[model samples]
Target: MSTSTSTSTVSEEYVSTASRPSDLRITDVRVANLHGVPFRSSIIRIDTNQGLVGYGEVRDQASASYALVLKSRIVGENPCNLDKVFRKIKQFGHHGRQGGGVSGIEMALMDLAGKAYGVPAYALVGGKFRDTVRCYADTPSLLDPHEMGERLLERKRRGFTMLKMDVGISLLWDVPGALIAPAGSRDDVSTMHPFTGIQVTPKGVEHLASYVDTVRSIVGYDVALAADHFGHIAIDSCIRIGRALEPFTLAWIEDLIPWQYTDQWRQLTEAVAVPTCTGEDIYLTENFKPLLDAGAIRVVHPDPATSGGIAETKRLGDYAQEKGIAMALHLAASPIATMACVHLAAATENFLALEHHAADVPFWSDLVTGLPRPLIQDGYITVPDTPGLGFGEINEELFRQQLDPRDPVFFAETTHWDGEFSHDRLWS
Candidate 1:
């Protein structure tokens, strides 16, 4: 296969691979919503007549409208003109959460371009730093310590050496008199629009500590253990919970408070010995800079779907390297975003691990075909050696099984409010 390189006028240093000098055209763009899973995601499929198809996804729920609007901007552009296409779409997309649409489309284009050239997506980003990407399992939230231990053992049996659990829920039998607040007390949390309920109580916290202790005891000290979704509690409550679980030595405490609270994150990192990680909801590298520059946390986590797809996520990871920070991708969606992350992790040197949320979903791995190797073995995913993402085939059967009932799979018309706006600025 012949390859060509193009440099952006804005930054001569920014160069990317182009497919055959003239064969680069986006033939088709389609979106699919994979529902009923932990999170919803809109997957974008871009096809080219050159017999190459690329896949990318914009995070679900938060900004589906933005991603849909981006389809118009990308429909006729040359897939190989990555720099030009990204620049053009970005100008129309603005920044912050609204950027997801443009970013998702950009990811699909790159995936298509890579397949056209017969190189993994990472190679286009400047080549691979690692052949195998480390994976962390998101364990289920169980009510019993014994049951939680059983779940950990199951994950361990499947070869996962790193695991994360939802530690904020207290409704299980493990905690007694743990929930103190009335259902309406956390109305503020309710209004946030994404997550609701207050399950982690004082007794619940103690039970959770015991649960972590049990998990750590069974898994031993060699494995990595992490926690997240600590409920909508005050900073002091976070501190207390952090202190209680200190003995287990968690890998990091994730999203203990809202991600917007930079000062609170810094304080939490300072107060706890465990490493701190956040930024799944944050949009791009620019949004991540403040936390990295402030030394707010030892690790930076970004979900490619929400943070702007592969290229942007790679930029964020590269920047984090400059600050001596590690990058761990937070992903929970369809195979489109999961495979996109694999490419990014392969290219990034400072990358630590990537979350495989669908590890337990029987058909999740089947959603895409032609992966160069098994998605996971002994808790590690071998990067695809084939061109593009090496995604084999979309398992329509599996997709059907996972579709969200509330909103069936269909391409809705792009709402008018979706894309870049003159008044929009990323950070206020």
Candidate 2:
């Protein structure tokens, strides 16, 4: 019982009391709302009793309440038990931004589990298929096709091998005889594609194809070009536009119609030579089944922040792979979410590319530390093998500078949320 003998008996391999994984408990969950770090986004911090912390981001433009409401459900649970906590809280989630809360928390859990066990997040998801994840830069639509081509060329000049641009019916709204839609319905975003009775006239189809022609001519065939935001056009319009751009060999046409329209997706996929893609709003793996089962699309684009975070998106990618469909991530949030996507893309075999939506945001890489200076290199993110999401620290100073004015609090005490309760059970 002598102190000297007791000290000598301790093994070198013994874990320190401070790092005990089993004893780890969720102490609190807080939010930092940031605005125009490009766009509004909420970053979630899950604190533990052991002084360890993990970070995640709500989908871009999503409200912070999406995460705060779930704080009470996880206050005392183990962060490492990801699936258990996920199952307990997932019922509260739904498709689109509503899923941000459960998805962000899942990411935080993956971070904590990785840090606790001392492995990269990808390792926790069965390891990686690649070291570097190729990124595709998103170039917004410009009225002038040549100007848009020049913008895409700038992306190429920055070393991006893949690029995407907006090609939709909106561009044809003012053009005489370009589009055939109800007089006042063109601007109404609430209208679904099929109900709008929108048709792309031959003139509109030609105009849309001209933009792709201009871009493809400037960027050349070596670059993998993609298009998105088809503006809720009907199936016939989508097919017409798709066929018109087939000569350009687009990587894929994204969200051609709503993801819920699997039958329409199949029709669009079959009618057009260009590959059809959707599912950025989809929430879970099973939700992607109908599209996959019917061979509705050639590529499945899921934003990890919306598609159930780390493990679930990986599962979605695995399922897509089995059905011979490729996956490309959709992300427009902070570097925290970007790293999460990089980890998922690395682990998923059929991952085609991870969308880099903030390539133009100068301070995007500055928001996180312990990574390379330029977060993206030559249109690819080198997957970090470091523990968790691979960033050593959050650049708090930068976050403070970019805080959303409406909710200027940064990681403020969330005690009010701790008392919130809901009967979340779906079955007896």
Candidate 3:
């Protein structure tokens, strides 16, 4: 794909050229499900006669229908006219996770275009600012203090100086009971259904504190400890939990309150000495401006897939930097998005750390081959200087092993509804 720009008083011309006489046709778009994972994602490949191909992933799980519908609109478009194609398709798709299809397709096209032009994806987004991207190890949920200590040590051994742990499971210590209790009731509130479940009980809080104490003792004060995945609890409950975990000197308490509660986040951030962070589920950079402007969070957490892919994520980080707020990326799922995050992190100056969920997956690092640099070393990831995402090929053997036999990841081609749904009037 080639890029060209021509300016005129009456009009402006910007066109991208495919290497061959024929345009780059989206030959195939496939969706694959990783075994034992929560959701299925769509991966699009745009192929050209020049033997150039581009790849992109749509963040859709349980919502594969949206991706299938998008394939129809993109199959015949020239992959080189990415912006034009993205705008055109986005007009028809504007609600829910369906936006992921358009966004994912855009990412793939950009990757392809960069390869076609012999440049890195970061180069396509202007240029790069750094080479090595800092990564943080996300510690899994642990029920026992010993288990938690072991996880922390493992992360240290992996060369990760920053670690995040689950501190909100105290509400689940009771079985056959609700996850969170009512505002002031000590009695079992399990009967309250989803409304009054318990997220942190007195006993559960003590257990969490003991666990944090254990982790602190093991990792010591040198490494950074962060906490997240606190089940939904009241603002007061979050403040209490934040204060309780203070001895660990956590880097931040993530998503303490739901992301939409800006004022509550402000209160929580102010109530405790620990820094507060959120924003993984938030949409575009525009959505993040409010939280950053209000100082509701000290650090901005954006998952590139959820926040409009690489370009938009970098824009969000640049905006956060302008506000003097640090940025930490939240990533989960396949290496497609993780590699994209690495490129974006490498280009942004305010980057703090990138999440590596597949760090434990033995073949996860090998899923993509021909990486410009080793995937990890001493807890740091070296960014690839190669064109596009710098991935040589997909490890079919590993992907096959991890494929969910029941679901079997494959793209389901189908047309979307052309008209508004009947339920649209109900909300109005």
Candidate 4:
């Protein structure tokens, strides 16, 4: 018998030996914890026997244990079978931060598959629609209206053409007679949006609109300015505020009321000239179907880390586009999650712009090494051609400098998160 085999006529025995479990078995799962603005962030790495690793992130403030527990179910399986792995794990996920675990795991799997096949993450989905992803920056609220105007001007100076800001009623807190509520209870938050009875006085309305007026005066009409964080006011107040700002021409007023109030969003959307947007905390596509079907809002904002990873978010965007709704991603995590959004935005045609929440952090872009230097420039991130989320390695030294001092651990041992706690099957 000859030991040598021809390249075209390779033996089945040789093929069997070269393929299967040995070449791509899962080896380990590790996590690095860092502080993303407003909360903490956990970055997970899925390492295989072949030395390739996939990276993902649990939504900021979500416990990394949500993803680590699934390690037992997938330790020895092929990381390349993303859909199979996702289906097996999707049952365990729910809405909000609960979805973070499953979505993060899905992101890691996509990263893995992208690397194994030598393609960009978006290529694994539906391929690229654009090479650069536009980004929007969030400006913090300032007590002084003039200072806020100056602050917004600085962002424009930095070349960001699109911006969002907090326009909550909290601004009118100190203004006597501006708001009327229960003696001590907060009127802005009652059983629901309509019942809140949180009306803005004629003066208060002017005060709130003045914030937008100042920003518009400085940044002018060239920028796409949006508003959010209205301090949980009623739909009526949201409409009142929205109506007052109609002249400013905002891109959208985000999350005017809770997303669950689909009818409220519809009413506000119909009543106001400004566009309405929501759904950053949503988890599944089906959950978003009703809102789109009702023509509830003009835009859908999904944070990939909280939504059902890439496929679900893309599905949401596709469905939104079908109904003429644009998708503007909501992201506030580290580079791990940012790249995931980049790939998703690349593959999605209706994507408007992804959010960049760490502009003030200074070291935010310094935490990762694989993507282009200055991850964002002039409000746009040029998509990287490299495989697996396009990041080379975690810049640990830089990351450590910004790690949350209260809980600093870089890929710490999580052996206890290794086992399943309960049977996850939902239906009998």
TM-score of each: 0.83, 0.97, 0.82, 0.93
What are the Cα lDDT values of the candidates? 0.75, 0.90, 0.70, 0.83
Candidate 2 vs 4: which has more lDDT: 2
With a 3 Å backbone cut-off (N, CA, C), the pairs that clash in candidate 4 are: 370-392
Model 1: lDDT to the true structure: 0.75
Q: Which of the numbered candidates is closest to the native, going by highest TM-score?
A: 2
The runs of at least 3 residues in candidate 1 whose Cα sits more than 4 Å from the true structure, single-residue gaps closed, are 1-19, 36-39, 49-51, 60-64, 91-99, 169-183, 186-188, 191-205, 372-374, 396-428
- Candidate 1 lDDT over 202-293, as tens digits, reads 77677768778877787778788888877676666677788888888889988887777778888888888888888888876888898988
**Top candidate, metric lDDT:** 2
Candidate 1 lowest-lDDT run of ten:
1-10
lDDT (tens digit, per residue) of candidate 3 on 1-428 = 12333234224324444353235566555565565322455455555556677766666452544445556566667776666666655543332354566556667777877777777888877677888888888868777767787878898887888888887754354534324555554544333212444456565666667778887898888988888877656776677778888877888889866677678778888888888999877767777887888888988997776677777778899999999999999876566766777788888889899877656766656667886334778888787878788788776777666665765654333233222133222234
The deviation in Å at residue 160 for candidate 2 is: 0.7
Kindly report the root-mean-square deviation of model 4 from the true structure over all alpha carbons. Answer: 3.0
Clash pairs of candidate 3?
A: 55-108, 171-199, 179-198, 180-197, 180-198, 180-199, 181-197, 181-198
lDDT string for model 2 (213-295, tens) is: 98789889999999999897788888888899999999999997899999999998999899889988999999999999999
- Give Cα distance to truth, residue 27, candidate 2, Å: 0.4
lDDT of 1 at 139: 75
Write the candidate numbers in order of decreasing lDDT. Answer: 2, 4, 1, 3
Supply the TM-score for candidate 3.
Answer: 0.82
Candidate 2 clash pair list: none
Off by over 4 Å in 3: 1-27, 36-41, 48-50, 60-62, 90-99, 170-172, 175-206, 372-374, 409-428
lDDT of 3 at 120: 80
